[model samples]
Target chain A: MRETGRPLLAWVGLAARLVTGIVWIVAGGLKITQPDASINAVRAYQLLPSSVAEVVGIALPATELVVGLALVLGVFTRGAAVMSAVLFAAFIVGISSVWARGIEIDCGCFGGGGTKAGAASAYPWEIARDTALLAASLLVASLRRTRLSLDSLLFATRPAERAATEGAMT
Target chain B: MSSNSKASARAQKAAEMRAAQNKREARRRILTIAGVLGVMVLIVGGSIGVSLLNKEDVKAAGAGSSEYGVTIGESDAPHSVVIYEDFLCPYCGQLERATRKDLARLAADGKVFVEYRPFDLLSSIADYPIRATNAFAVVLEKSGPDVAKKFHDLLYENQPSEQDPGSMTDDDLVKLAVEAGATEGDVRADIEGLAQQAWVDKATQEAADSGVKSTPTILLDGKVFQDGRTIQDMADNLMAELE
Candidate 1:
């Protein structure tokens, strides 16, 4: 699976890449306008210390934006995919913890400063969304190549390496 | 095929395996490069985010300025009650609900001038308080003192439970004002233009500077009222100060 080169997989990778990329950009863009609200949103989970939450709240949007742009442009496919996976996974953990604590909260993934949000887990759909995005992220990370990716152009494999890659896949 | 030739073919396969390993190595290099670059971009963007988040450009909202607060009663009222409040604060809500009419009566009688200063300590608790404060600031700026106080009371009356996330929006605020007989006229500007933000920020900063540590921080005739004062108490104090 690691070495296999399938044109079909490339298409799947592109789909995942674009979808995850857009989600990150949109989520980050919405929160950037209200940094304080963004901070509140981070603190909503009760997972981090207030000071730490403040930093994450202020910085996460920017990181998400950068990662999104990278993924959409297909500039750094593997790295962006990994970042997407980490972020989604972190969100999953946060939501799950809040649910476990019987605490109410909004994920604040979009906007509105995430304060006093009623139970986040009450909406199982959010958990489901993050899970799906996580899967997409993993899929993007696994594939060595994707359609319209800069990876192929700048990091083209030599014929010898290509043959070896195929061999390993087999 | 001869045995020697067949053996050579096996060796060639082994070489192909090695070449594949090399390709994997090269792929890793590419991934590493991209990952490094991605992290670098995030660092740059994050620094900008941090700086912007920490930055607060505050200015004096103005003395007796309607932009930062609303004044009730004649300017020359012998004593004044300056209240620093957050509309979404449950405590402030309690205080407001408790003494609203009495304070108005005091104002009507011109026994004391009442000023409500909107501050934002709980901006991190939820966006609504800040949003509401910003909206109130707008009302104070454009809608005249009467409408501003009305809008202010309306906000406390309608404040969602502290646990509700993203409850109030600018549209909701504008609608409330219109319902209370006020026009939108540049209300959007006051809210969106952040025209009142600097003033609110200044007021909040000054409140902090003046050792105001909590909501309902009331100053009666330039003295901090250690105990929360009710309307009756306020009237009594006015009389005492007059004497």
Candidate 2:
């Protein structure tokens, strides 16, 4: 710890931010390509009223893409983190609700999120993934700044100070 | 030193510290407000972009029957059977293999009109399925319905296993058509063309909009037959549905 000099917690938050962004981008990119399927995936949840489900389904992939890009680029990290946390929390609730209702479905975290038989027991793992993502988003939000981030770039006045402080290379 | 004056000085310093803290909070509020506005712009802008792409894809698809499904029998036929299918799906292949003869018989007797509506769900996962769907549209557009049916059957007969990475290319499919007695006039060109890619997307979109979720989704006069698990069961269900 002494030799490395930087705190491990900062590195953890940075890693979480990047990974969470990647997941969102991939999920959104895949779903955006197949909008109708994305809607059906949302419908599979059977959580929202049908009208609300339609709106959420149509808007979700686009929102994810934007948030993911912002987070990955370290532009508006806190805001993107906020969006990520909210989406993951919603996903966790959706998965849990469906599991409790005995509705068998694929989590649609990926492309083929649809209703099917025999996958009801897989809810816990799905919830776990979302929970992890939620934690990551929260951590990223709480951090004041990270290396290679836009926020740090804005705050640091001198080039030397910026170069010296950006220790988030890993 | 007067004790009262010292106490007042301390109180003034505390007030100044509180003022600075409030200023920091205000700046943070401003940053967060900008952040929210920026995110909203991204979401709305992205949604618009996606909508535009969807429209462009649909427009490029060009001349297709809004009537849904490719016809296989007399229009005046008393019964209607619509088969929603994805060529690369294993279960779809099974359903086609199992019910092909019966479906043909039903069509031949003028008892039912069959529609082989090409639906795509596996294409997002694999390139093969949508490419084949495009090829099907190309063949249908150029060589009439009969030759298209032949092409469809041949594709199924020689379909690569679902896991096979190197699925049939358009060239191979054109060759299949030529071998199946297709008059190689522009049929091959159509098969090899990229224009049908939009058509494939459109067809798949139409199917998805109609709520066709899986391959080999069978409907008798628009009603899904849920109780049938086998050929005999399907046949029995068909007969029962007719009444």
Of candidate 2 chain A, the 10-residue stretch with the lowest lDDT total is: A1-10
**Pairs of residues at least 3 apart in sequence or in different chains that clash in candidate 1:** A104-A119, A105-A118, A116-B163, A116-B164, A116-B165, A164-B20
Clashes of each: 6, 1
The C-alpha TM-scores of every prediction are 0.49, 0.48
Interface RMSDs of all predictions?
9.0, 8.1
TM-score of 2: 0.48
Q: Which stretches of candidate 1 lie over 4 Å from their true place?
A: A1-3, A116-122, A159-170, B1-43, B46-243
lDDT of each residue in B1-243, candidate 1, tens digit only: 999999999999999998897878788777868776877676557755664755332222222543467888876877777777777766567667667787788778877787888888677677676678777777766777789889988888887777773677677788887766577776865675556677668766776655554555566766655231233343344445633
TM-score of 1: 0.49
Best candidate according to DockQ? 1
lDDT of 2 by residue, B175-230 (tens): 87776557777677777765588788877888776666665666776665434433
User: Candidates' lDDT values, in order?
Assistant: 0.72, 0.71
